[model samples]
Target: MALLMPASLLMVSATTSADAADAPQNTTNARQAKAKGKAKLVAMPQIVQQGKKPASAGSAKAALTATIKPAKAGRPVALQVQKGKKWKTVSKTKLTKKGLAEFGAPISKGGKALTYRVTAAPYKGAKAVTSKPTTTERWLTASFSDDFTGSTLSPSWSNRGIYYEPDSLRECSKGDPSAVSVSGGTVKLSVIKDPTRANERCVAKKDGKSTGSFDYRLNGHIGTEGSVSMRYGFAAARIKTHKLRGQHGGFWMRPTTAGGGDPRAEIDVVEYFGDKHPQGGLTSFIYSTKNNKAVKTGSWIKSPTSFLKNKKDGWSKNYHVFSVEWTPKMYVFRIDGKETYRTKVGVSDQFQFPILSLLSSDYEISQMPGGDKKLPQTMNVDWVRLWQA
Candidate 1:
């Protein structure tokens, strides 16, 4: 880890300007990485002290709630709010018990933005073990874009049969290329999980329609190798996920190989497994070098505690902007301009020049029961873009 120095460390007093003879080496690294198009991970100044909790005075209130499915029968949920750097308990309520599965209250704190954390528990004796809890935290940023007109994302991204699922079958014409067209000014990719006649398929679809246990391959995956590799830049996508039910979808980049498999590298900007389990999450990972080891980092933003709780968040219905800024030293993953995870490892070796790819894959969620029903799922993407520094 690089030592983060305070910006105040460079203060020059009225007596004399700080001389170069006393400049610190850590400061030099920060300046160099910035010059090379890398973002510096500077630590925020620590809070000197948190004054006593402010009494609930003003009249602004907000509500946060968690719930279970099947109409009106399930466990309760809790929510936490972070004011500045401190976390304060906000609300707790029974999702099914009160007929009001959601909790709401006035947030007296106004003017500034508010961040929240939501949590849910499984039903009684449901066999769903609670793991780490999922966290949904967001702060406002001015650079967020809800548009997708000129991105590199398309149903026919690659030459051979679009490297992804189409947005609609009408566009695909019973799974043909002619029917697949970008509509509504957004790039949408959709897929079917039934037994297919195509040689290669989007095996990640969890539709439970496979004829037999046939060896299935993916329809689309991105790579910069061969004629598509990018050196260093910011790649992003304005994506809307499909109701995968039991699939994984997101943006990733992999190296292309000459023979059978791509042994070069795989960088997953954001991988979401639409499962109701703690293991399912939005993750970022890198498989580099000859070893194929996954050096990864991701945040369990939702349903981190239990997979069953994950299903209620509605990942498929929302449009999230997934992005990756790959520089020479670090890879930063962001969703809707909110920084979720950042990794700095083997910086020089793996990301020397990473190619960009957006992909979707599927497999068993676990070796436990009820896992088989979650296969044949699909992941949707709207559009993807690349920004060079």
Candidate 2:
């Protein structure tokens, strides 16, 4: 202390003191810069709009998602719709852990077009941000619709696979008029024991080899093959699927032409394989030909229960709207207006018609414990509608 220190050590001590004196100011400047920075909001490129019938009041909604830069979790985001010249908030939600906000808004009104945007209020240190406005396309009245109000199948639908010709996939089942009935504003599609072959058994074969023998069953299969078809648009049906794993309940579409070559794609909007199936058995897929070879897209839906109304609800317990939006670029599948899956592969450009069926294939018959005792599994269809682009 009293003695003089070395010149080099003295210089080092002075420098250390200076740095300590300036540290607080440096941190203050950095904090000010961050507090002045503005957050950025980006919205999805396309907003899908759905058409709803008079009976489906709240089902006609669209999904909108946006991301906030710098990732501020729990930040508030508002979805706004353009009302006249000003924007009105329609939905409000908090940002997810990934700084993303999603909103489902009841914005579709018959054939009218609507515009929407997202806004994030100023947060702890970031400035307010707004997303670019997105205008939805006009959704006109559905070109094809059946409410199933009549006591019989409409002229629009025809029975399918009435004859029992064995196929590699469905070796034990065939369609019959008795398996389809219309009443009470709904069409009942059932998989029942074939009365004509009540005492006979059907052998399921693959590649000319018999795999197993099953009870002869008749399926409920019907389609609008000749009466209604669309090139690209939205198709939807409200259905309560069959309750057992032995049969497959499907809301699907196929090209009007018979051949299964290029440009002929099969679009399965939704398929359910019963409640107890280990895989949840909910699927959406497409089959198409590419380079003269078969190609398939999509798979079983993950977290299928997330689409249900509650823990007590199931595909067979309540009716859910299954829909597919087809465009030139891709197909988007949805359950109850919420997207389940999407794919750009195997996009069909040909006119496609909708088909509804509850099929009992020989391969799946073993899944049902009681065999023919669980024979008559019925799927109910409340209605079907199509909006052409």
Clashes of each: 37, 0
Off by over 4 Å in 1: 1-156, 159-181, 193-228, 256-262, 290-313, 348-362, 365-378
Kindly provide the TM-score of model 2 when superposed on the true structure, using C-alpha atoms.
0.77
Clashing pairs in 2: none
**Per-prediction TM-score, please?**
0.43, 0.77
Relative to the true structure, how large is the alpha-carbon lDDT of every model? 0.39, 0.74
Best by TM-score: 2
Give Cα distance to truth, residue 296, candidate 2, Å. Answer: 1.2
lDDT for model 1 comes to 0.39
Per residue, candidate 1 scores C-alpha lDDT tens digits across 190-249 of 333324544543332224433223223233333334544443545565454544433355
The segments of candidate 2 whose C-alpha lies over 4 angstroms from its true place after superposition are 1-75, 82-88, 94-104, 107-115, 122-127, 132-137, 205-212, 258-264
> Candidate 2, residues 22-80: lDDT per residue as tens digits?
33457765554444322333222122322222244224455456666545888888989
